[model samples]
Target chain A: MTAVVTGDLPVIEAPRSRRSGGGNGTNFEMYAWIFMRMSGLLLVFLVLGHLFIMLLLDGGVQRINFGFVAGRWASPFWRTWDLAQLWLAQLHGTNGLRVIINDYAERDGTRFWLKMLLYTSSFLVLLLGTLVIFTFDPDITG
Target chain B: MQAPAGTLYRGREGMWSWVAHRVTGVLIFFFLFAHVLDTALVRVSPDSYNRIMDTYKTPLVNLMEVGLVGAVLFHALNGLRVMAIDFWEKGTRYQKQMTWAVLTVFVAVMVPATYRMVAHTFAELFGSTT
Candidate 1:
C-alpha cells in the first residue's frame, strides 16, 4: 500500500444518533420520532385484522373478490377503519422511508431528489386511497 | 477478553434487527402502494376488480403471501421491541434478550401460520370437489 497524504483522507464523522445537534433546531425530528412509534402501534391492530379477514379466513385469498370488498365497505365502521389505515400506514411508512433516505443518501442533491420522489408517490397513494375508500360504490357496474 | 477497536453495533443483534426492520419496512411500503392501487379497482367495475384479484389467487403468489405475512409480523413485533428499548428503563440492558424474544415470537406465530397457508394452498391445488 502506498502512503496516503493526510489531506486526502476523508474525515470520519460520527453516526447521526451520536451527534447532539444533528437537526436544524426545529422539533421536526422529535415529532417524526414520536409519530413512528404511535402509528406503528395503531397499524399493528388495523393491518393484522385486515390480513386475517382477507387472507386467512373464509378460504383465504380464494374467497376474496369484488364482492368481498363490497361487503366489507358496506359498513361505515369498516369504511372508517380502512380510511384510518390508509392515512396512518401511508404517513408512517413515508416518514420511515424519509429517515432512511436521510441516513443513506449522502449527497444533498441526491437526498432532495429522492425525497421528492418519495413524497410524490406517497401523496398520490394517500389521495387515491382516500378517494377510493370514500367514493366506493358497490354497484358501480349496475 | 474482546478487542475494543471494533464497533459494537456491527455484527450484533441490535444492528441486525435495525437492518431487518428497515428492509421489511421498505418492502411493505411498496406493497402498500400496490394494495391501494388494486383496491381502487373496485370503483372501476366489479368484473375488472375481480379479474385483477385473480392474479393474487395463484399458487406462486400464495407462497409469497406467506412470506409477506412473515415479514409483516416480524416488523410489527420488532417495532414494539424498538419502543421498549426507547421507553423502558431496563430495555437497553436487556435488548439482546428482547431481540431473542422478537425472533421467538416471530417463529411462534409463523410456524402455524405457514402450515395453515401451505395446507390451504395444497388443498386448493390438488383437492377434488365432490
Candidate 2:
C-alpha cells in the first residue's frame, strides 16, 4: 500500500463529486484546464483580429455583404483563420459549459443530460461550421 | 463559523476576479454563437449575406463592439493569470498581484483599441475629414 503523502503537506484525496477521479491518477481535468488557458490566449488574437477587420476596418460592418465574404474566402489564408477560430471557440465554450454543469448540477442524471446536450450541440455546430468554411461555393446561381 | 452573507465577500479580490472571468466567458460564448451563424451566411448568395450584415452598421453595434473588445481583453489576460496559477508554484501566493497586473494590461490594451474602434466608426458614419 503506497502512501498519498507529498512533501510536508497532508495528503488530501480527491472529492467524491469530481468526475475526474484525480486521486486515481488521471489528469484529464488538468489538461483541460491547461487547454482552456492556452486556447483562450490564442483566441484573444484570432478573435480580436477577426473583429477588427470585420467590424472596424475601412468600410466597417457595413461593407460585409456576400461579395465581400466571397472575395475574402477566395483566399486560403482567411479560410484557415476562420476554421481555426470556429474550432477553438466551440471547444472552449463547450468545455467551460461542461465544467459548469459538473459544478452546479446536483444529480448525476441531470449533469449527464446537460453535458449530453452540450456535447451534441457543440458537435453539430463544429461540423456545420467546418463544412461551410470548406465547401462554400462563391459562384452558385439562382 | 461562516461570515454573515452580506459581508461574506468583503475584501475578496479572487471572488470578483472569478465573477469577471465567468461573465466574460459567457459574453464571448454568445458573441461566437451569433458570429458563426452570420459568417455561415457566406455560404449563401452574397446579396443575402450583405443584406443581413447591412443591419449591423450602426452606432449601437459599434458601441457593442467596444464592449466585446473589453470582454475579450479581460478574459484573455485573466486566462493567462489562471495559467500561471496552475503551472507556477508561486502563482497562488501572488494571485492578487497577478490580478492587478492583468487589469493593468487590460486597460493598456483596451484604451487604445476602444479609441480606435469608436473613433473609426464615428468617422465612417459622420464622415470625418481628419
Candidate 3:
C-alpha cells in the first residue's frame, strides 16, 4: 500500500492471493490426481481380469488354494501381472485414502497420524506382496 | 449452508455417482489391503494358506465375493465415466447420460458374472463339480 506512482491513477499494490501452491512450488497433488486416473484405467483391466479368473472362471473360489497360486505364479505372465497389480493398486489406494483423510479428518494431528498409519500399512503390503511373488514356493505342497 | 444461487452438481445422478465412487473406492482399498496379506500367506505353510482360503470358499463369504465383484465393477465402469468427463470435449454436456451409461454397463456385466460365480459356489458347497 505504500508505493504509488506520482499521478498514474493512484497505483496500488496487489494483495496476496487467498489460495496458495501446496506450500512448496511442486505439483504433487496434481501428480497424485493424475496418477489416480492412470492407475485406475490400468487397474480396471488387471483387477477385473483377476476377479474373473479367481471368482468366475473354473470352479471359482472352491478351486483357489496354495496349489492354484503356485501354478499361476509359475508363469512369468501372471507373476508380472500380480506384481504390477500389487504396486499400482497399493499406490492408487494409498493416494486415494490420503485424500479421503484430508477431506474428512478435521483435526490436523488426527489427519497426520492417520496418514502415517496408512502409509505404514500400505508399505508393508507392498513389500510383503512383492516378496511373495518373487520367492513363491511352488513345491510348498510337497 | 445453502447454494441459493445454483450449483453444477445439484445432488442428482452426478452427485450420487461421486458418492458411490468414493464409498466403493474406500471399500475396495481396505479389501485390497487384506487381499495382499492373504495372497502373501502362500509364503507360509500351505496348510495355513489353504486353511484360510477354505473360509473364503464358504457360503457367506462367497456372497461377499459377489458383493465385492459388484463394487469393483461399478468402480471400474464409473471411473471411465469420470475419465470421459475429465478428458472429452463434450463430457460435461453429457455427463448425466454417461452416468446412466456407466450403470447400464455395470448391470450388464454384473448379471452374468454374478450367475457364474454363484453357480460355482453352489456346486462347490453341494459337491457337484462342473
Best by DockQ: 1
Candidate 1: where are CA atoms >4 Å away? A1-23, B1-6, B127-130
TM-score against truth, every candidate:
0.89, 0.80, 0.89
Task: Return the lDDT, model 1, position B65.
Answer: 91
What digit string (tens of lDDT, one per residue) describes model 3 on residues A1-142?
Answer: 2333243353334665545445677779889989999999999999999998988887888898888887898899999999999999899989989999999999999999999999999989999999999999877753
Cα lDDT tens digits for candidate 1, B1-130:
3333344466799999999999999989999999999988888899888988998888898898998898899999999999999999999988889999999999988898777776766876898551
Docking class of 2: acceptable
Question: Hey, what RMSD does candidate 2 come out at?
Answer: 6.5
CA error at residue B116 for candidate 2, angstroms: 2.5
Candidate 2: share of reference interface contacts reproduced: 0.44
lDDT of 3 by residue, B1-130 (tens): 3233234676689999999999999999999988988887888789889988998988899899999999999999999999999999999999999999999998899899889878967876789967
Which segments of candidate 2 are over 4 A away from where they belong? A1-27, B4-11, B120-130
* lDDT per residue (tens digit) for residues A51-140 in model 2: 778756775665667777788989999999999999998999989888878888999999999899888888888988999998999896
TM-score of model number 2: 0.80
DockQ, each predicted model: 0.42, 0.36, 0.40
Q: Candidate 3, after superposition: displacement of residue B44 in Å?
A: 0.7
lDDT value for model 1 = 0.87
Residue-level lDDT for A132 in candidate 1: 93
How many clashing residue pairs appear in each of the predictions shown? 0, 2, 0
Ranking by TM-score: 3, 1, 2
A7 Cα displacement, candidate 3 (Å): 40
